[model samples]
Target: MSGNTARRPLRADALRNYERILAAAQGAFAAHGASASLEEIARQAGVGSATLHRHFPSRRSLLEVVFHDRVEALCAKAQERAEENEPGAALFSWLGDLNAYAAASRGLVASLLHDGRDTDLLQQNDSCKTMITTAADELLRRARQAGAVRPGVHTEDLLTLVSAISLATEHPDDEQAGRLLDIAIHGIRLHQHQRAATNRETPARFSE
Candidate 1:
């Protein structure tokens, strides 16, 4: 779900070139949106247009790699949170990370949707979505088990809420994003005594 599993082995120099292209593309896309020029990207990477083309083939391919790398990093963070003892804190912290990633990639979301769409881009997006869903579902389940989160709060609900916050504050600061997440997390979190009572009442559902 993280690494380039299907990609063939590249020569050391080729790999360096590839990494340069990706790094350059990331900066260009961040500044110029999804429709940024291929020539400019190639120039920034210090590679000829033919070289960039040979590696990425198309604009969507390059965009997919950049977005995929972000998703991979986010997934890694989620995995790290899963290992932590604090379920509620881990979930909330990971949600904060998601908010940050969304904020940073403001330009890329446009390419994942209508008009500028490509099959490869859509598939890559779907893969990233699946990885995120799986990670969030595990964290949410753990929180619910610990009674730190309310029952019936599925992965989709948490994602939708955070995604909305991210989109709403696309041009705003991290404080705004954090405040909104705090509000959402507060609504879902259960208190200690409440958790105990809920566990008793819904033993078959929550407690093992």
Candidate 2:
């Protein structure tokens, strides 16, 4: 899921064009929100309008590809962080990455959702939504198993939490994002002593 499954193998020349289009599109979206000109994108990619449309028939199609690539990159980062010795540290770091991605993706994702089919691409099989959800599930499972996270914290909760952070920190020079992340981490975590106390309390009540 992390490896960009949205595209199949391409011939060398075709692949070049594909990569060029993606690169150009990414830059354009970053610079001009999601409504950037497709003609300008073709120009930047050094390809014709026909070539661009051949690869991505519509603006929504191109946006889906770009978002897929970005999600793939984030999935890669989540995989890397999952291997760290400290489960809590790894989860927090990945959460920070998620927040950053969400913040940058604000406008672009909105545009995609405006068009129904493009939005479906993200939620459909083998799409970015699946990739991100799988990664978050794995990371959360690991953190909980390591006794760092509280029981019953779902992957959706983590994503939703970060999404809210991104929205709240949309303005320039906002420091609340990091502070909220810290708060979220603490909220989801179970201190060792807290777990031990809970265990003791449960047994005592059952024994009585």
Candidate 3:
């Protein structure tokens, strides 16, 4: 038998390594916040630290990649939800999922948000932020039209829900997020009730 050995493709291994690194980094960031070490990332990924450096070069670079990937995913999800027939349901579903997505990003989001506007990834067109907002707005509008969600529900409030969830999910319990979301949704729906009570507390005054 001729002992001819075919060279295994580095591309396949490289791709696999990249995927593993991302998975490990994501878990590490969520578990330990943004300051988690690259060594630990490599350990979780089963790759040497040298391999991590080879792919990411620097911590900031890896962070930017993670943030960019998360934003793109959110945009895609928004688009998919918008295409659904029920806009309000799509909006709520996407809003809930987006919080999950952002929560998953953990430290990555904080880094990206703190970046200056001049940063490439933070530029207006670079991040899919506008597109996602637009998609979300359309969904909210349709839901309002259908009388499914509260009227005069601005997109910003739905946005606040995602941000709230992101901040609230720091605790480990997975159900904490859903509870936070429910609280937000309930507040939005009962906003008028709150305002009415506030008005009632104020004395009726007439200038004669």
Best by TM-score: 1
Worst 10 residues of 3 by lDDT: 1-10
Candidate 3's residue-wise lDDT over 101-188, tens digit each?
A: 7677655446445554324544534435776687677777777666566545688778876876778676566588877887777655
Ranking by lDDT: 1, 2, 3
RMSD of each: 3.3, 4.2, 10.0
- Model 3 misses residue 122 by how many Å? 7.9
Q: How well does candidate 1 score on lDDT at residue 203?
A: 56
* Prediction 1 TM-score vs. true: 0.81
lDDT of 1 by residue, 1-208 (tens): 2264477878998888888888898888876778888999989999999999998888877877888887888888988987875988889889889887777777666644534556356555778899889989888888877768877678899989988998898777779989998999888888777777886786566434
Which residue pairs in model 3 clash with each other? none
Off by over 4 Å in 1: 1-5, 46-48, 111-124, 200-208
The lDDT of model 3 is: 0.68
- Summing lDDT over every window of 10 consecutive residues in candidate 2, give the lowest-scoring window: 199-208
lDDT of 3 at 128: 59
Q: Count the backbone clashes (under 3 Å) in each candidate.
A: 0, 0, 0
> What lDDT tens digits, residue by residue, belong to model 2 across residues 1-208?
1244456777899889988999899888866777889999999999999999998888877877788788888988998998764887788789988887787777665666664445665466366778889988888878877878766678899999998888878774446888888899898888888788756664443232
